[model samples]
Target: MELHILIKGERDISGQIYTQIYEAIESGRLVQDQQIPPSRLLAKQLGVARKSVADAYNRLTYDKKIVGYVGRGTFVSGAAAAPTLPHIEAGKAVMGSLKKWGEHADMTPLETAYRCAVDFAGGEPSAHHFYQDEWRSCVLHGLRQCTAKRGKYGETAGVKQLREALIRHAAFSRGVIATPEQMVITNGAQQALDLIGRIVIEPGTCVAMEEPGYPGARLLFTSLGARVVGVRVDSEGIDVDAIPEQAKLIYVTPAHQFPLGMPMSEARRQALLEKANRIGAIIIEDDYDSEFRYSGQVTNSLQSMDKFGVVVFVGTMSKVMFPEMRIGYLIAPPAIAKAAVMVKRLTDWHSNTMVQYALAKFIADGNLLRHVRRVQTIYAQRREKIQAVFGTALAQWFELLPTNAGFHMVALAKRDINIGELIARARADNIGLYSLRDFYYEAAPPAGLFLGYGSVDANAIEPALIEVRNILRAMLWQQKT
Candidate 1:
């Protein structure tokens, strides 16, 4: 490869060449095992004597930075691996801030060292549910209808068609009552939270989040400079008594808790609302993927029960559709509805125009609900298989938590077991597993497995879980030994 070397003056041309090449190696411009140009070629390019180029090559060889084989020519044999230059004082401060941001980054569906054949990672939706043919038609319809005004940016509050459709969908399905004007479509539920945080949170604003909650929401608020307080979650969901009265914003997954799957008891929900009203706090109710409940009293969204107009309801299609379809919406409490819409406008100036329209049509034409119903049956079956296996094959080891809804469920280990080691061993046997370790903002997270069956097929469920049981048994036996 041609190395860029400038031969300025004829004096000490070889020295200049050697120094430049050395610097190149040091800077990683020339990496290890990279071939350099022949001395003769370099000499001709540099308009210098071949001997001068050869002398430089000889010096590099002597330093063991490069070596030449008879036919292979010169290659970078040895060089001090990539050298780190001293950071500037200004850069140090920026890097320190970056490190702080890194600490608050989202941790979910963790990347395992090995690719597991049967992955039980949370946040994945089943492809069996994806309305490929129906969605294709909807998208084509959207492209035709939505692009009529192709030059215009979509409304920050989402397209009119979507807002209207979502209003109907939410009311019928989740019992959420909202006007089209209050709906602010976002990139995803994640963005909706960010927008809410932007309007309500200032530096050191007191925000309460469910401990062992969705790490994504916790980190998002943390990044926004909110003083996030972790409230303990038990069988009834976030312990309302545990939340500080001063917490300005309270984020809760009331329908189904994240990582640890437990719906908030109605009494607890009422108590939480009273607390919020007493303290004048806004509640962010993330009703993510509550559509696939197997068996339980059909719980209406917190928005339906909101009398004080204090709850900002968030919903996403990612769990119902594929996760890559980054679309979600938020129904702001009447007081902050305009403010949330304004913040959304400033944040990204609205989401994908065509996508919003396509989703609107998908919902309006009943494709979305039909898709959900079909998949709901399949998912229920998968959930049943996992429950049966854990009940029969895995009962001795795991106590299945009380959960009746969502793509995943929680099962606490029967005794003190190394949850981390259990995960590693399961992964080794080609089953990706997760515990509720990373979600905790507090030090002590409960010992349990968050078994998600969304992507796993019904027939594959028993075999995969059987293998998991086998591995767990071996681990337990080894421990006894």
Candidate 2:
């Protein structure tokens, strides 16, 4: 190892070397068990006599700071305690320039506790039912294949086999038709949104989305300096006529709108496509958590109905499998898809190749479908339990939103109630509840609770809701008095 010891002026050579080495050890620059350069070589490099280097080594060994072996030369015995440096506060000017949208952004989603006896955290899936053995087999196959191949950076668009598998899966399941070339694999739906934002949004670009939409998408657009317009959403999903005429991009969670849990109506979907075509705006369809629909007629995706090539459909495996898998894809028109590929290359090159390969095999081997079917049954039972409880016990205080798809449902407060206080009280009782206020960007969001059935098991749902009903009744009575 090369030691950066500076011996300047007419100081005692031996003492200077000793002090420098000691300081290096004390500062943790010289770690324990690290071999030092030979005394002869160090002396030659430092332009000092062998005696000076020898004296320094002798002192360090005597003090037990280092150990010299017969043939092993010298090695640091142990690391010294690191010295504390003077703290330097960031200057106001520097701090001011670093202020971004995230600095003042709503942090409710991140701050909310996830673990509880009854968790209603939206977008979370039950990992307890995952097919561990099947997934392990697929992963081992991918690993073996990857080990045999040349280790280099894969394509930015992602593994070709996975794209092909997604094409088949999307076509068979969501009615979205796209070739492998039109898709770009991302880390997750969030990364897909970020890539789209990077390619489409410039400073002051007009972007329109649902009023109470996904916070992740809203925060992404805001951080990019886009002029975001919040379009009002009804029971039929985002109101098409409310969107600005000059919007370059319109983000929508059409399969099941975030927080509110309503699918976009057929009439609204057609009108939205017409409006986007007339205005030359691109639409981002985030089809998150549409795989497990419990009731009502299943609706085709906006991308499947799109004739003008204005829709970019984004989907994720996080809801179907798990969030930590971090795999999602976007299907776009050739022009936008090509640009998205380039943007993805610039962002992080590509996602995990092994996972992608494993997922491709998983999908091809029918394990993915089987897993979704298994979990769908579990989630449907929980959803039913939630609906039954709400109908019987809590119907007076909360109005359940009409929802057929997705793992979560929203219930609006029937009477005036402090949502913030309710959530705090619920937390105190070991019940995790999430509010809808953070989903709204520019509109007065309704007072509601997003009840998710993904994390909480079927057996626990009724008990949790029973307790929630008692609490709600008490709060309502207190408010009246």
Candidate 3:
């Protein structure tokens, strides 16, 4: 067998040979029990003295990095392995030429705290409410169907049945009119955003988003070398005039603006569409959590209002169903949809066929609609309970934002207080809270907490708020003293 050991000009020849061989073993280039070249052959190849090769082999043997049998040649040992160290060096010098946006991209999955009695972390759905038995039956049926068509790849756009189901569901519920061919199924809304960014954003391209917007979309665009512009959002929703004219893409949570839950007014939505048309920009409408409106009239999606094909509608089942299901769809124009399908094929060759088939059945059999209707009632009660408690007890510290939709709401701090300190203190009291600062990309966000009712039990909310109120009172007292 050929070995890749190098022998230097005489001085430290044995040491050099030993170092190279040891490195090769550690890096897995030389695997366990793989025989090394005979010392005589290695010496002849390197034009070095046989004794020097023998010496290097002896040193490696002493370190247990290699082993030899009486009849057989030397082999790499199981003990020879790479050192377990921090993946990235913690210094600026090592991160040369790393893009600024890449530095800000946090790919870590959101973790749920096991120790907290009440968790207000946003974007999580109630696991207890999921119809496990029905869902399992659907999964089994999907598995059987998938097994029947073994060895064949499903469509990149999605399973035909699922797309048709989504089209019907979207049209009936959200007023979004799109055929199955215009939709592309993705892993989640994140991947949909990534695909849009891939096709649209070039280096130095302008991407406009709300100031306190979805950090995931911002990070995705920024990482793709787009100059992300933060637009101010008011109670009416994203200010249409505030968006940069040069922006190629605009990301908006129009149905329910994230953190601050306010659906875009119809007039504002029309103005946004006009602005996008005039500027030739693509609007990504992330209509998340529009299913659970406790009160007020439902507004048609911006996609339904589009006449010029500028709005690309993106929706997710994660918030309505469960996060782990990882199902989302994008409705775009035929041209963009074709390109996106090609990109989707390149990305992962389509999302999980089995899960897609299961979700299709779940929606078609009206289980999804039934689930949403049931959960909406429960979430409505929880929302009222939170508002009642806050209006009476916790209103002194927090000014609750006006919202009629979505599972979460923001409580802006009434006084000058450190939200981080408050979060830390609340955790000690077994309450989980998140800071609004986490969502902001440019502007200095107001101090606040995102109180989500999706994951917390309806019974535990009032007591949790009481604990939160106590913490805020004590903190305010400390600040005054």
- lDDT per residue (tens digit) for residues 1-481 in model 3: 4688766577988889989988887777788888998889999999988898899999999999899888987888854454444476557864654645356645322465374788887888888988899999999989988998889999999999999999998898899989999999999888899999999999999999998898888888988889999999998999999999998999999889986998889999999999999999999999878988887889989999999999899989989999899999999999999989998899899899999989999998899999999999889999899899889898878888988888999999887878999899989888988888878878998999888889899999999999888888898788789
Candidate 2: where is the Cα deviation over 4 Å? 1-97, 101-108, 477-481
Candidate number with greatest TM-score = 2
Of 1 and 2, the candidate ranking higher by TM-score? 2
Error of 2 at 184 (Å): 0.4
lDDT of 1 by residue, 44-111 (tens): 88888999989999999999889999988899877657765667555664987877866655344345
* CA RMSD per model (angstroms): 7.1, 4.4, 6.7
lDDT of each: 0.86, 0.88, 0.88
Candidate 1 vs candidate 3: the TM-score winner is 3
TM-score of each: 0.81, 0.85, 0.81
Residue-level lDDT for 296 in candidate 1? 80
Worst 10 residues of 1 by lDDT: 106-115
C-alpha RMSD in Å of predicted model 2 compared with the true structure? 4.4
Clash count, candidate 3: 0
